[model samples]
Target: MRGVVLHAPGDVRVEERDDPVIVAPTDAVIRLSATCVCGSDLWPYRGVEEVDGPSPMGHEYVGVVAEVGGEVRDVRPGQFVVGSFFASDNTCELCRAGYQSSCVHRVPIGGIGAQAEYLRVPLADGTLVATPGTPPDDLVPSLLAASDVLGTGWFAAVAAEVGPGKTVAVVGDGAVGLLGVLAARQLGAARIIAMSRHESRQALALEYGATDIVTERGDEGVARVKDLTDGLGAHSVIEAVGTQESMMQAIRSTRPGGHVGYVGVTHDVALPGMDLFFSHVHLHGGPAPVRRFLPELVDLICDRRIDPGKVFDLTLPLDRAPEGYEAMDERRAIKTLLTV
Candidate 1:
């Protein structure tokens, strides 16, 4: 089997690796059908995140179950499934409370890496959701998106309590933020403001039902959003960039008492406690409980209510992952899809 491995920053390669097998009674082995590169992958690619040795890379995946452990009864071999980036025993207290990302037995899929021919998923019954059946060829990408970005965006919208009659602001124009705009619209946000400087992404945001687009940066961006909202700021703000600047923008663009749903994989960030205390803004974010929203997102994708795959502007073979990384890092592609 072949998988993507990062030897070091600026060095990603596809090399032969041993195929994964069911190692636990709660585990399942999946033969990946599709996978993708995430924005967070760039951290290591750009040398921002340290990598001491060869490490597998990828989390978002849609695949067919090749085998299942003895304890995994719900998901059987040959079933097509989509799973959250974080694997969790859905019966845990946190999972039962709808926070599977924080489950007591949770395991992050990226740590194991899904950008390969096969992946071993822990807590199989809890983490993997079987699709209606083998979906149409075109629907594969959408289902794959549900495994991460779509689910994260949906979680962000829910965290912010976005719904009818509320104004929502989305910071960051990456795939997750773009999907956040879509989530806001589906959640009944009356007005969706997507803050982006990229024309292409902004256009897609509009197509996804964004009511307005702000092309400014930093304070100017917040001012534009406030101006559009009559100086009250948005009722809900989705922060998808996971950076200091983007976080500040989200907080500033949101009205007092408004909610901020941040789903970006936080890197080096230090929140100002005083500012947050004074602003009276509510903040909620961490690894998204994608499992909590998996069922609904799967139904939406199956019914074609949303086309989250639009985020993948470029598709490449799994072996060409290096090019995929370069394209995304160079801003030449919004997201990259890898076909196994």
Candidate 2:
């Protein structure tokens, strides 16, 4: 099979790789229909995250089940499925408590690298969720988003405790943040303020239900949120950019007792303990337990209730995976969908 590997920063390639096969009784191998470059992928591409050697890339995916191991009774060969970056036994104590990403038997699917023709998912029965049926071509991207970004954004909204009559302020304009706006709307946020500098992203944020857009960033951005909320900050804030400035901005943009759902893979952010002690705000986030919401998100896509696929503004063949990474790194595209 052909797959993507990163030789170094600013370097990505498509190369021949060994095909995946079931190695565990609870594992399943799926032939990918589509995959994509995530914003997080930029971390290593730009060298913020170390690439020790030729590292395989990608995790978001939607595909057909090519084969299943003996213990995988929840899905069968020939069924279409979507999964999370982390594979977890959905029956575990943490999973039952809605924290599958932290399940006791969790496995990182990123290690398998879905940016290829085939991927081996362990603990398959609990990790993979099938769509109502094979989704049409038009719905493929949306379903693919559910595999990661959409689910991550949805988890952020839930963590923030967004509710009816509350205001949501999202920091960041990447796919996750933009979809955070959408999730906020779906979760009943009465007013959503999307902080973005990109015109294209701002437009999509409005389309996704942002009631307001703040082009300012940093301290000015927080002040803008306060200005829009009568000196008080938003009722909920979603921090989708993992940076020192973005994290502080999110923390300062919410009212006392408000919630901040941060889902961006934090790079090197450190919060001031004294500030946090006095902020009187709630903070909750981490690697999203996408498996917890895959079923609902898949149903939403299959039912045509949401269209998160719009986040993928660029599409390329598997061989052009390098170009996909370049476009996203340069911000020429929000996300790139790779055709298998």
Residues 138-206 of candidate 2: C-alpha lDDT, one tens digit per residue? 999999999999999999999999999999999999999999999999999999999999999999999
> Could you tell me the TM-score of candidate 1?
0.99
Quote the positional error of residue 214 for candidate 2 in Å: 0.2
Cα lDDT computed for each candidate against the true fold: 0.94, 0.94
How many pairs of residues in model 1 come into backbone collision?
0
lDDT of 1 by residue, 1-340 (tens): 9999999999999999888988999999999999999999999999999997899999999999999999988999999999988999999899999999999998989889899999999999999999998999899999999999999998998998899999999999999999999999999999999999899999999999999999998999989999999998999999999999999999999999999999997798888999898878989988899999999999999999999999999999999999999999999999999999
lDDT of 1: 0.94
Name the regions of candidate 1 deviating beyond 4 angstroms: none
